[model samples]
Target: MFQPWLATLLIWIPTLVTAGDPAETPWISLKPENHNGKHIVFVTGDEEYRSEEGMPQLAKILSKHHGFHCTVLFSIDAENGCIDPGVLDNIPGLKALDDADLLVLFTRFRNLPDEQMKHIADFVESGKPVIGLRTSTHAFDIPNDRKYHRWSFRNDQWKDGFGRQIMGETWIAHHGGHGWQSTSGIIPADMKQHPIVRGINDGEIWDPSDVYTVRLPLPDGCIPVVMGRVLSGMNPEDGPCEPEERDGKTFDKNNPIMPLAWVRELKGSSGKTQRVFSTTMGASQAFTREGSRRLLVQACYWCLGMEEKIDGKGNVSIVGKFKPTSFGFNSHTKNVRPKDLLD
Candidate 1:
């Protein structure tokens, strides 16, 4: 489902600079002069769920409101230089990772080259912080024959790939109806005092995206923050459905929903137990909600060891207008370059 680009990238690569880095790939950046020295690099390359649109908005909020330098890289059609999620192999600017204090990734089954992937592997192995959005659980879908196949989402040697080992879980199934059923966040009554969920409340989490199913007990070190309750309707105020019973156990559906947002502590090759924030939410449609954006912003502070800086009333407002398209395969805006995102 590759859409052909109207113009080749060679015609625009040299002249495009959203953040002025001048890389020959589709990457947008925002550097706030008011500044925290940390750099946040966002990787977006999912064919569905519009990570490309969501990531940029997030970078804008972080840069404008919080003073962090942000860079967003996309999947590229090498020949034409267009941003194409269908083209999984090429995502320029992994070099941005080397200098990044944090990496926020939202990709699905990406089969990147060894050269590009090595950078990610180094980052994870080094124990730096990271935040994974929907689909990133199974980010790399490399073939077994490839040198970096060990990083694949469902690889045998790695025991469920990057998402499970590094983050929390790999791609599982959908607990609710894929498109028809909506989900809402139900904060644990006891964890309300936690900084990440400080300003958030019960039933405030609403998204058109369905809830993702994960096995009980995420990797031993993970802590569940907000659980996703399957709603009978799409609206934020929709009532949650009763849990379905199976195999002699009555599942209390919304009474005790699936953990959708969580944090894990894993030891990296650097002998440091770095923080990892993994969430099953955060598509473009989901980002339209202020609650979801705030959760992720809080996570950035938690991951960077700045939980002390979190305030219940911190600014997480969107920097510009964000009218994102519905999530679907082959639904991205075409004939646009990385520089186009600046406008």
Candidate 2:
């Protein structure tokens, strides 16, 4: 008779070793056929708006449909190795950024250690392209005394940190009513022919997340691509917002829509100008719409200087079943590891 307990122990030891090993940073990587020879790394750690849930879905689309190698790194619980967006400090597998051609960042208020942050800093300094989604504008909240404090969203020296210096804006107040209003995309008249908005039509893109306020005219070298019309309700068929008194002034939200999406050409420390795509709407619920998914897919091609290759009606179908958790604070699904998404 074989000893069942002894056999189980031997089988379990290897699994324990791999999970406990510090060298093995937990992450999910998706490889694509018909390789485009580019690697896109996604950093997801936002508490609300569900970057943790959305980034992976986006990565899968990029890989399975577009032929880019996509890797998604999430904030992990130290004690149990589960994906935990509430953990504001640690996001393992950032070293993947070293070889990344483009970075899709959606972190909010992260205060990672210097060693982990150095990887992101080095990548940004390399003059590579970047895509900033929703809360990424206010991504870091490092203390003033920290080594990478300049990246903090509220730093005096850096002047709004990476969001302002690189992505063209930082955390301003919500332009639309947070939960009550929705955002409808409008292609700027001048930008209708732009490659990024190639296949998308006005009003096709809608997100439940409200528009964020950005200072007027945007910054130098930034071009607005999509304007967001504030809607009266969360449904796509909802009417445009009515005139209301706000900030002691009468305002009509739809008259002058906010910049929903834009592109920037910023000079990095390496003396090279890199392309950046920033969109104020990328909540997990946003991608449920076909227009929202198409816009992002095309933007990735545009960022990589492959704009000419974008198919106006390319396949942006969901890779597999994707039922994302609703956007909220402290509502992330617990005990779920990055590896769990491999299925």
Candidate 3:
């Protein structure tokens, strides 16, 4: 089904400029000459985690390795036009989704303007593929007056909004200790044969970020792909710890631990079932490990309906020198632009 608008998008083939603006938002784009004709648009924003850095690294691998054209949109401080994740209001260049085949979202508590958010809503309504990571489960934190307030992590209209209704889970409590504990990916017995975990080893999938507490049985027909094992330390060799008993309840860490990565089918407003891939394991430091990188790469292929191209050996080698900053509040590199990330 060739959409008329999609045909026009192919003609432009790039992120268009916003002229006459003094402090225009900076965007990063990579369109390979030998392209796969598919565009993956990454939306990065968050105060705590370094999603700004993680988005670019994922985009580079998808563009440079898999031959897919990728565009990364960052949260910019409009006053100076520099990347600023703490500025939760503005995220320009979402119009790039007009041509995007997939939307890889990594935002947290974003309350974008109607003009900007319409692009994402339109994309979701169009039934396109979507991939979200980490804080994306609670991506939007809109006010009650706004039209897209229903898209927030907690909402009465849609009941837990996009994350629960569409992506799987909303902002839930952390299963492990916030900064003290680490997590290692443990492939579920049922998910071992799944393509997303095909090339990934159980112990290989580890991250410094703790495991998120999701509902035992995920909503919206989600299949649990990887479970996070709360580690005693940050190292991959760290020993697994049992879920602690807090107050009257016990946080289940080892005995049927919480899910770290999974997939969902979002039944959108367009009456289309959109393919959605989400994970809680995409912190910048997590990408340093080969297993974590391969898990995400495989999910991309699966989301785009190109599972046959997975190759199984998990050839997800890092594209270049990747040294991501540790996740924290206002932890992003200051006074930087999108294009400057490559240099």
lDDT of 1: 0.84
Residue-level lDDT of model 3, residues 273-335, one tens digit each, is 788888987778888888888888888889898888777684577765578888778567899
Separately for all candidates shown, the number of backbone clashes (residues 3 or more apart, or on different chains) is 2, 0, 0
In model 2, pairs of residues that clash are: none
Error of 2 at 18 (Å): 14
List model 1 lDDT by residue over 1-343, tens digit each.
Answer: 5444635544333222355443454788777766788889999999998898888888888887787888899998888878899998999988899989999999998999999998888887888999999899889999999988988889788898888987789988988878777888888887788888889888766778889988887779888999998988767788886667789999765554689899888877699988999999866878878888888888998999999989867888876567888877888988667766765
lDDT of each: 0.84, 0.87, 0.82
lDDT, residue 232, candidate 1: 80
For model 2 the local lDDT of residue 60 reads 80
- Candidate order by lDDT, decreasing, is 2, 1, 3
Give stretches of model 3 more than 4 Å off: 1-25, 243-252
Any runs in candidate 1 off by more than 4 Å, and if so which?
Answer: 1-17, 21-25, 242-252
RMSD of each: 7.2, 6.4, 7.0
lDDT tens per residue, model 2, 1-343: 8899999767533321222333355777776645589999999998889888788888888887778888889999889888889999999889999999999999999999999999999999899999999888999999998899999887899899999888889999899999889999999889999999988998889999899998888999989999999999898899898999978999997767789999998877799889999999988988888899999999999999999898678888876657877677888888887766754
Q: Local error of candidate 1 at 139, Å?
A: 0.7
